[model samples]
Target: MNDVIRAPLAFRNQHEILNMHHLIIGAGPAAVTAAEHLRKLDPNCRITMLAAEGVPPYSRMALPYFLVGDIEPEGCYLRKREGHFEAQGIDVIYGRASSLDTVAKTVTLLGGDMLNYDKLLIATGSTATRPPIDGIDLDKVYNCWSLADAHRIIESTNEGSRVVLMGAGFIGCIILEALANRKVDLTVIEMEERMVSRMTNAPMGDMIKAWCEGKGIRVMTSTQVTSLADDAGVLKVSTAAGDTLDADVVICATGVRANTHWLDGSGINMDAGIVVDDCMATSAPDVYAAGDVAQGRDLSTGDYEVQAIQPTAVEHGKLAARNMINGNATPRGGTINMNVLDTVGLISTSFGLWMGVEGGETAEFSRPDRFEYLNLQFKDDVLVGASSLGMTQHVGVLRGLIQTGAPLGKWKDILLVQPNRINEAYLASAQSQHAALAAA
Candidate 1:
């Protein structure tokens, strides 16, 4: 933007990536992040955003706080201040991208119009999926993935209302906390043996479930929601165990799937998600993907994983924009599986593969009576994955060890004998890495 001239491609290898138009599909945090970064880099570049919903770009993560009345609906917006997009010269369209034509470099909207772009980014994010259970389509049944869902739940329920929640995953647990704060007679039903299966191991997850139940919330684990029925305006939820629970409202937070069905015939390398390289570019030229819609490599495992969390989305969003400016000039470091959760008053954290890998060693300590637990996974002498509850100081140390891949050496033996010495182990191991680097 500072005296840098951009122009169209006049030769096969010659290019002007900055002087171009960017059409981004989706208006979530990722889209907004990329748009702002692009504007800063190329002030005169044309940018347009498209989203299926009609609201301003907002973060789904903040919706839980909105339910507890801590913040108003407008507070959940990513760019809450008025005229944000207009001031940035970002043109927003409220429509779905129905298809893509890579050869023509145009995107087809649901309304039968095609939009052209010099570079296209798919940040459409993800959609919450509901299980194939009967009565899921009932009026009181809802999900917590969108802002509209939040409005419906808030409008329909009152304090002390009977509520049945399905799925105790990360998103579900957040909503669970909000519902508890609302004083709802809340009951949770999770198909997994415990809670937060994807983030923590069985023992840690079981402890979380116990902590939730101890808070006077009824938690049903290893259970299935068979069906639901509305009788005289009352919703009755039937479980697989032949038990029936009645509810004033049903909230489903089972899981989410990438919202990329519209790209089925788009000639993009499609799999469970859109295949993308470390640069965040798709198989096609000038077409990149990020957020949940992009299946990029996982740094720890080197496998393609969809991290639907907001931080990963924001990082990849910015990374993809930089690559768009220079044609994959700055490759991505890849994403890791990381999550920190606050269920009620309890704090939990997980990083990388919290569950120990094959032939990997593990160190664990637990005090079920006090709801404190920690598990560390090690491959050879290096810490690879970890999960913890009730320990805030361990958060940075755990991530640092896993990310730096520093050898634990003597510290590994110390952890296996007494995992509570996390701080000491981290200090010793980090110092060892520093000394080794200096010696070399």
Candidate 2:
């Protein structure tokens, strides 16, 4: 025989009440936007945002400009003022979420407290990945990912300081511009054959390399940094090509990795990132993930890919919030994956997969003396991708063409006849969907 404890009539309403607490696990743009959206949908809902970083979220994309002193600390902030999130009915917890209990629907904070919630959103962004090199933990070796890292580099920089930057990606190029502006002896070492190799094609890479060199920044390609040693007060960086460079500081801009360690043992599907469906829902019920941590589908390749850009993150947050509030809304379409690196005076923009050698034929126009190059890649008689260096006026047209999978018939003729004539029939057909949206 078992005795059962029943709830009293007065306490019966507790079981029927819905717990509308929304717990967001990050403080970056994605999490912040998601909180705002949730608040708009349900003003009385309990919204708690957990951030591993102590300070509130700031514009990390502007960190290079901040390092160059082009923008002050206050200008880099995304929030207009302090307590702005609080005014929006968001409770921010400045502590790392150590673990997740999916069964209990609770997040375990570092301080031995568990937050139970009806719905949870994992928007923990990414962290800079430091290469596994000897002496990488030296005091002078730094990674420019956070606001603190930017401050460290800015404080350590000087007129005659020799700074060795490892990796020549977008961030690396921006750092080169920032350091060169300070008149520092800047040397960039990249493992790739050319600068921004992963992002841009060969022609665009050459144009950017020339631009960097024109600004007195030494761009070293096909090189790998093997080790870093603190020689007295100076930092000695050894490269794989048997070359060594001395520097006052070493900035590693290799790349970033998804911050998903908290999901370990939480029964969430993760492969390099949190695996979410089209609606940004996790394997566990009522749990969602977005931003850099969520490996969403890529439109160009139709495969799950991690897009760590800010705009994609913001859009993902908005879409996730809509799906959460509306029960099951259609997932938003993926972005075309565009990157614009405005370093010094050079404006380099690359869209989609512009370097698929086997699947496409490339049509290029280059004015080496003018420092302008454009490469258009076509596959199956459709414009698949495009890259523009030192010229961006035609980027919008190219993006529209790529997004709509516009046919490449007579494309070369149109491009040669009047490059600015993007309002022609083919281009108009490519932008019909956008036109429809605008009309609506």
Q: Which ranges of candidate 1 are over 4 A from the true structure?
A: 1-18, 431-440
- Cα error of candidate 2 at position 19, Å: 5.0
Residue 189: error of model 1 in Å?
A: 0.8
Tell me model 2's lDDT, rounded to 2 decimals: 0.79
Clashing pairs in 2: none
Candidate 2 matches the true fold with a TM-score of 0.90
Give the Å shift of residue 207 in candidate 1.
1.0
Model 2 C-alpha lDDT per residue in residues 1-440, reported as the tens digit of each score: 01111212221244335647788988888898898999888766777787776766777887888888889876777787766776776777677888999888898877677778888999999999999999999998889988889989988989989999999987888777788888899889999998987678777788788888888888889988999999999999999999989999999999889999878888899997998888888888889988889888776887788878787788788878877787757575565677888867788877887775475776677887888777777776677777777776656777777777766567555664444444473555565556643432
TM-score computed on alpha carbons, candidate 1? 0.91
- Model 1, position 259, has a per-residue lDDT of 86
Each model's TM-score, in the order given? 0.91, 0.90
